[model samples]
Target: MLKMAKKHNMCFALIKLSQTHKQQLPAWLHCGALLRTYHKLKDACLKQIHEVKSIKDLLKVSNRPTTVPHHWESHDCICGLCVSDRLAGCKNPHKCISTVAVIINNLTPKFNPFYCPINDGLTLTHCRLEKNTRARTQHRGDIIFDPSVSETLQLAECFRIFAGDTRTAQAPAHRLQRPNQGQGQQEPPIEIYTDSSCINNGKNNAQCGSGIWFGENNPLNKAIRITGKTQSNQAGEVAAILIGL
Candidate 1:
């Protein structure tokens, strides 16, 4: 009836029609413009639905009291704090904390391998880790540290050698030996060290730099300050490795 009134330039408020007028409206009058309006309305309805669902999920996981102090023990009723902080005046304001209040009070604790702070700061900011964005072929295993074991000490020694610890005056006896094959000894493997640095890391204006080091005073050694919007410590590390290769 409203569509008909609007189409005929009739006053919508003045029309006195019952619910039966809904079916009496011509189907042809509801074709083109009505379909477009319905599509727009559908989008708005879906947006509201998604917003409600997101709020529900957020509240479900959050440790917040959503009601007045008296009704907090009840499971069915929501708190007045959802609408406004002072909606329900009560003495115990602590029992009416919102989700945002709970988050702010707790400082957004870390949950590893998912939503966590990029740095060690106790801020409300978080970074999301999507499973699809990670490499499917590679597996990142857990790390175990034990200084008491002899194998751990041996592994540390090997790591020091691979990382080019110049504190050692000479290479170990095992590393100096060459494999003998048919009366000919094979040459030792070439070792290169690559590293990266990022200043103001985890920020939008972060700067990243990479460096590749061969032997002392080697001509192949290079230092590069990376330039681009894609600047992070990980990106710099990958860039240094690629350049070294």
Candidate 2:
């Protein structure tokens, strides 16, 4: 509707201006005179939508060529050249400069990978371990020790030492010293570590074992023989902790 109103006004102004000025204009100037009058009417219509800052801008807007219809094209519209002219000047010079400065400051610096900051000469390049050294040996020959004799000796010593030490039997001190308890008397908290193994995981004889380390020196240590279930050392360790919990 706005475009139609602009065209109608332009046509009316051209007719009126030509009738008034025809006597003073030459015959060859008819087209040029009408075109100038049409542009003046178009400029007046544009003034209602946008601000004109200077005489130069007003004259440029008022002297732009009129668009002629093309029959080969399905629609008639002016190109964007005149519309871009309306927005050409920067209204805020300071804001434009600040925006450009921010853009320049954000760019990342380029560096060679061989001389990159993290890889620049301060890092060690090799391991320090001796390549062919052998570990020390523990015993020259195997002499099997009697497991029951050692156990009996250990148990006898424990009994002798604890016989005079009444603290282990004292319920109040026992409960107070219990690692897990906060107050009063209670059983000590126990932590267990376990492991298991199998000859074959899918369908063969399997074995599992678990060991308990109780108290500071791992005293009262015990291990259980397990079979028929397959698992790794890590899985056994987890199972031990779970059972202890």
lDDT winner among the candidates? 1
> Which residue segments of model 2 deviate by more than 4 Å?
1-192, 196-203, 215-220, 228-235
What would the per-residue lDDT of candidate 1 be over residues 119-205, giving only the tens digit for each residue?
322222222223322333345533232122111122122222123222322211121233465566566788999999999999999
Q: Compose the digit string of candidate 2's lDDT tens values, residues 1-245.
A: 43653444331111011111322222221222223232343333234433443323333333333332221111122335433333544333222223323322232111011111222222222331121111114433343322121111221222222122222221111111336656587665655554454344444454556666665677565565543355555555566666555
RMSD from true fold, candidate 1 = 28.5
Per-model tally of clashing residue pairs? 2, 2
Evaluate residue 185 in candidate 1 and report its C-alpha lDDT on the 0 to 100 scale.
54
Reference-based lDDT, residue 162, model 1: 25
State the local distance difference test value for candidate 1: 0.42
* Number of the predicted model whose TM-score against the real structure is largest: 1
Pairs clashing in candidate 2? 194-236, 194-237
